[model samples]
Target: MPTILTFGDSNTHGTQPMRSRSSDLPRHARRWPVILGEELGWDVVEEGLPGRTFAFPDAEMGPHMDGRIGLFIALESHGPIDALTLMLGTNDLKAQFGASPGEIAQAAGFHLDVALSDEMQDRHGGFEPFLILPPKPFAAGCLAEIYEGAAEKAQAVQDAIRAQADARDVAVFDANSVVSVSDIDGVHLDTSSHETLGRAVAEFIVAEIVEA
Candidate 1:
């Protein structure tokens, strides 16, 4: 079976709607990454962290939020992966970060560049880099205050990221076409969204990447 490294942020970490506790190891059969493995019968390594950002080091959230470190770790830690999937950047919209969608998208492209690097690809025999654009979050629920004005910025992420992914000639998928973020917290996902989004991503990969 082929293996895939799904490196992403909280949503990929299976964060449930309405944040209140710390994120633990992978769970939820309905979680998209879990569903991804089930639907495709492929080995899926889930690497997700709360508050992870592709652009900046968060002050309040801690320096660990720098996603580049985690991306390198995940690539080095896993072996013989056929693909690496990146789904992140929403956290960059934090009111504090003040990052524009274009900057966040560019930062995300950095990961694609890393995965496609000759050294990293050779380490795994070879691998394809895939980008999954995160669904835009609505500013509401407990996170409303922290994510103030995020929704407007979220509106432009898809196009911005698409432009970057296109420049790299990487495969990209828009998660919003299939599922939306949970209305509960706007930052996390509901079980139903996971089930739907997971299946959607699985189908996209199988049709576009695996069988293409």
Candidate 2:
């Protein structure tokens, strides 16, 4: 089976926005990655870390929160992938980080370079990469307080990603087009949204990668 590796944040980790962090994690069946695998009959490897940032490291969230470092590790662990998907940048909008959408996009481009490095290409035997612009954040409630103007920032990030994808000739998918953030947290995905996103991503992969 062709293997696809996904690197992302809490949403990709199948976080249940309505559930407390102390509660049991969402079941594998609820995660989009698993759903995508079942839909495509492809091997899906999910590497999602909560609070992950493309370039910045969150001391409060621990060393592993740095997506740059995490991506390297994940690449080594899940090498020889047939395709890869990246979804990140939301955490970079944290009040403390103060990163603009452009900055986040630059970081994302850097990560894309790393994933497309000679070593990675050799491992994967050369495969196309997908850059997914995560769904826009809600403008109300707790997430609003945490990521002020998140919706606008997400839009800017999406534009940057589109430009980058066009320049690099990489496949791009807009998560916002297929899914919406949960109203409960205004950040994470609900189970239904996960299903929607999984089906959408599966379709994109079939057209962009499998058929191509």
Candidate 3:
């Protein structure tokens, strides 16, 4: 079976939407990466971290949140995967970052730059770098205060991502077309959304990348 890597933040990490940080975690069977693997019959390597940012060093989460460095580490560690996925920027929406929508997309551009570079291509022996644009976050739950004024910015990111995909020539999938963030906390996926998103991503990859 071919290997595919899912790289991103909490949603990709299978964070179950909730009001507060708790011990509860989504089961592997429900996580999108697992679902994608099952649907595609491929080896899925998940490189997801909560609070991860596209290129920013998080305040509470510290510098480890920088995806540029994390992605390089993941790519080097996993090597020779058949393909890879990028889903990020939502964390950058945190009020702490004080980043604008365009800035967030610009960070994503930087990340794509690395992914599409000679080093990463050589590391993976060449594979499609797919971008998964997340749904607009609703700041109406426990994270409301943390994501204040984030809703509008989140919406803008979708367009920015699509534009970036066209400019970069990377295949892109809009998560909003399949699943929105759970209303419970407004930043993470519900169980059903996770399942739905997993299937959607599987179909998208097959049609857009594999069979294209």
TM-score per prediction, in order, is: 0.93, 0.92, 0.94
Compare the candidates by TM-score and give the number of the best one: 3
Q: Which candidate would rank higher by lDDT, 1 or 2?
A: 1
* Model 2: per-residue Cα lDDT over 35-97, one tens digit each: 889998988899888889898988678878889999889988876788898998778877778
True-vs-predicted CA distance for residue 63, candidate 3, Å: 1.1
User: Per-residue lDDT tens digits of candidate 1, residues 53-169?
Assistant: 996888987898999888888899988899878999889888998887778888878888899999998999999888998988878877888789998878687788888889988
User: What's model 3's lDDT at 96?
Assistant: 83
lDDT of 3 by residue, 1-212 (tens): 78999999999988778767564755445799999999999999999898898878977778999998999899889869989999998888888888877887888888788889998898788888899998778787778888888887877876886787789999988898989887888888887888999999999999986466
- Write the candidate numbers in order of decreasing TM-score: 3, 1, 2
* Per-candidate total of colliding backbone pairs: 0, 0, 0
Candidate 1 deviant stretches above 4 angstroms: 19-29
Off by over 4 Å in 2: 19-28
Distance (Å) between predicted and true CA of 26, model 3?
A: 5.3
Report residue 146 deviation for candidate 2 (angstroms): 1.6
Worst 10 residues of 1 by lDDT: 20-29
> lDDT ranking from best to worst?
3, 1, 2
Q: CA lDDT, every prediction?
A: 0.85, 0.82, 0.86
Whole-structure CA lDDT of model 1: 0.85
